[model samples]
Target: MKINFSSKTKILLYFSVALILGFSIINTVSFFYIKSYIDKNLSKDVEIFKRIYMYEDQSKLIPYLKIVDSNQNINQNDIVGKVDGKYIVVDKGKVYTELIHFIISISLWEIFILFIILIIANHLVQITIDKEKELKGILEVFILALTHKIKNFLGIQRVNIEILKINFNEKALMRLEKAYMLMEKDFEILIQALKSLREFRDKREEIDLKTVLEEIIKELESIYPEKSIFIKLSSFKVKADRTDVKNIFFVILENAFKYSEKRIFITDSMEKNIYTIKVLNDISFQEKGSGVGLEIAKFLANKYNWEIFNQSSDDEYIVYIKIPKK
Candidate 1:
């Protein structure tokens, strides 16, 4: 038979068992100590009873000084007499031991406290498990989408490149070359996205920030030879994975050109322990249908614990990335 239980019920069952076991052990130890204390007091009471019954050297019953163990509930008349010129009174231990009363009285309160602690521990464990499951699902979906796109783009690029290699005529060859070039550009973008995912797999190191920016700009300029981007260098360092650094710039550069109809200005600065890279273009934000470039850039920046800012004034749109100085 398949056994099934709701999540709440399962948590309660486990918590109750743990709470019971812990409280049971504590009560057992407390009971043992209380029992030992009571036994010690009872032995002392026997000696006190002997002294009360003795009647000088004659050792005969005086009737007035009758010995009575404190454990026995004597009449008021029996306890109204003195023993050997001293008034007799019962010791407090004979009526009830403090340790025994304390153990029994606090058992309920201790059990209540234990129940509260167990409930909190169980809930915390459940919350952590749920959040971990959610993050895993998101990462799995991202990896699947990236893999599918990369495979399809590479297949097309491979076919075109092979065709271009076979052609000898200049006219046909030139057209094939252009087609292969465009396919290759798209493939590079896909590859950059893949590298961004790779950083999530425990691969991060100090990368040369300036060198990565230079390479991305070179690749972007290859597509539009007439288009130009000015670079401003800053003496700063970043502790980020090489793949991640390259992808960050690649996404931003792609976004700048896609939205702007003119030249893009790229500048870098280091102030107050922050390494900021700004991509400025003469364009304002507009409603575009399903674009992932800016979204991915922001995602990568936030994932690396870097700050991203986007602002527009007049006709200039600025994208700023602030990485912590390493």
Candidate 2:
């Protein structure tokens, strides 16, 4: 069997174990030390009582002694005598023994309560750290995605400009305009993505899955017209932030286009409030590209409680996304 614990749980477990061990050690040492101290005092008192009984002071000791049942058996360390029609008994260490037990019980209770409070404090601290880490990761991914998108647009603009310089035709001008439009659209998407990242709560609304997939496909077709693409999608509704859904689709589709051999296939279906999208493409295993986009996609999927699965063969790659409907 395997057991997994979160950071908070693990920390609490470790601290609790240490605390219990520490308290146990302290209690054990204190108990023995107290017992030894009481025993020493008890022996001395017994000696003093014996001297008084043997010599000059049974009457003086009567006031300090306690009356016990005559039938009670006295230990060798206890002192007993008859004084004014009552049997007086002086215990060697019974009082101190009870005091020790009472102190230990109270100490154990205090330690148990303190352990609970410390565990709660540790859990709260762990929660704060996790939230900060999540925010930092999202910010880092946003910056990297923005940089990658800008660089790609710049490269496209540079190519179109070079073509214009060489040919200076209406065709070149049209291509430049198209490139500018794409850059503008990408800039808008980037803004939306950043906004989505900043939101701390889900802003879910009904979204048409078919429309989102079509938009992604159209965008990719514009960028790589030569790449053959096929889509088999059913009309379905999902509840999620529009920008988040669009970004997830865009990231995966963009990667598919970037690495696919010559064709991309997309299929989707909806059943029992769950929508599954599968993307399959032919690509060699040796041609694996940088996985930054997929990483970002996976992160976003986790945030939205969606599932993503990837499988690759010698010459084919496939990705599946399972998202719940609102």
Give me the candidate number with maximum lDDT. Answer: 2
lDDT of 1 by residue, 131-194 (tens): 5664565466455545654565566557666776886556555545554665566567556655
TM-score of 2: 0.55
Give one clash count per candidate, in the order shown.
Answer: 0, 0
Off by over 4 Å in 1: 1-24, 29-204, 223-226, 257-262, 271-273, 282-289, 312-316, 324-326
lDDT of each: 0.65, 0.76
Q: What's the residue-level lDDT of 86 in candidate 1?
A: 45
Off by over 4 Å in 2: 1-107, 205-208, 215-229, 235-239, 254-264, 269-275, 281-291, 309-318, 323-326
Q: Across residues 129-218, which tens digit of lDDT does each residue of candidate 2 receive?
A: 778888898889878876876776677678778988897878667766766766676577678877766777678898898899899899
User: Against the hidden true structure, what lDDT does model 1 obtain?
Assistant: 0.65
Give the Å shift of residue 228 in candidate 2.
Answer: 6.8
Alpha-carbon TM-score of each model against the true structure: 0.54, 0.55
| Local error of candidate 2 at residue 202 (angstroms) | 2.9
Question: What root-mean-square deviation over C-alphas does model 2 reach?
Answer: 9.2
